[model samples]
Target: MPSLELDRYLGTWYQLAAVPQFFNLVCARDTMATYALDPQGNVSVRNRCTTWMGTPNEISGTATVNDRVTGAQLHVSFPGVPTQESLEGPTNYIVTALGDDYSWALVTDPSRLSGFVLSRTPALNEAQWQQIRTAIEAAGQSQCMYLTSPTTGGLSGIAPLCTV
Candidate 1:
């Protein structure tokens, strides 16, 4: 399968939804992600959020493109924490799909075991969401496990999976 193109992939992206991950557990509102080139030429990640009770939190990290042949693959770690405090295992971040206008993206991991749907806007239309769902399934991931993005009212309703 083709990997995500790096240059075209850099920019601010809104988190549409994702599986529950440790790093994001405390994030309760308006979560978003931004990617940029660092001084050393690595991908920089900025994740921001608001607590459930309305406190703001932010984290910054740097990611290295694992395979230039497939720039879609990356290994990321937070800069705020010491290397010893980094994740015990490397997190695989793979880009499975990209929007035609670079307005949205579908990201899965190496095993297609976990993933997220992101966009430039807080909400996505049925068509765009369906496209993400299709890509997730085709990649062998479980769409049923996808939780709702808090961007849409703080996760009150169940996240409906797209049916073919």
Candidate 2:
């Protein structure tokens, strides 16, 4: 429910964990996303990950702000991919939680079927991780069961799974 400053939110973000998506099933490590404001005022999204086979995979998309008042909701669409009937609207993604410094963020869809824990770095401190977990639970999600920690080569301090 917190409003986000669009300018501060645009940058590279490493995916610490996520509710597994079919398209990202092959991702094994080094998952990341980058956001940039386009000339037309839309947000450009670029996501990349190291596949299980050690290959780098990537996808590009665009996001349109649906609510300027809150700056917390948007609709993201990837070209060449069929839009799901349920997500064919102005707002499909919402920033449910964001760090004070914009160093991290928790994003989810209207249905809460997909969730992502993103940060400026591949690793997060214990306190930050706890904060994200709490936010995930506050958003009506199962933090332990749903969030799957990625092996980004620096998560030794964090549990591989969200069980902790």
Candidate 3:
């Protein structure tokens, strides 16, 4: 894992695709996440999305560095969200892959059970999508498990990666 620069990674990232999760089931489109530096030297996480009911759904949490050496591994927790994601507690949030320019990233846990494809923009070109798939495969994950996150704006009405 490459050492993640928290400073460069701090910003809003559009969710291009993600492995299904109960917490995000409420989201129908326009899913995004923002990160910022917190006073305690940790990171603050704010995830937002458009609900199926046409309303907004958001969650705020904290992400603590789990692997200081790499700064690629973290544990994020939101209020009322499940914490049983790991035996050591806290939901594992790892930056398995990242673009050098910090324009895109692939986030997952140690188990690779849940994964997210995040980008600076809501849409990605074919080459970018292919590169993301390659990165996911290198991380030992099947791209077939991912579903394209629908967006009302941006590129709009894109087919899921699973079909590609």
Best by TM-score: 3
lDDT of 1 by residue, 1-164 (tens): 37666777888887877876777778776888889998888888888987777898898887887767868777878756655135334547878887777777888887776778888888777777778888877888778777777675334443645422
lDDT of 2 by residue, 17-132 (tens): 88877877877788898999988888888989887798999988888888878989999888776773322366878999998888889999999998888899877788988898
1 or 3, greater by TM-score: 3
Task: Evaluate residue 111 in candidate 3 and report its C-alpha lDDT on the 0 to 100 scale.
Answer: 94
Error of 3 at 91 (Å): 6.1
Query: For each candidate, what TM-score against the reference?
Result: 0.84, 0.89, 0.91
List residue ranges in candidate 1 displaced over 4 A: 1-3, 80-91, 152-164
**If ranked by TM-score, best first, what sequence of candidates would result?**
3, 2, 1
Top candidate when judged by lDDT against the true structure: 3
* lDDT against the true structure, each candidate: 0.75, 0.81, 0.84
**Residue 112 Cα positional deviation in candidate 1, in Å, after optimal superposition:** 2.7
lDDT of 3 by residue, 52-150 (tens): 899999988888888879998988877776663232354489999987678889999999999999999877778788889999999899888888888
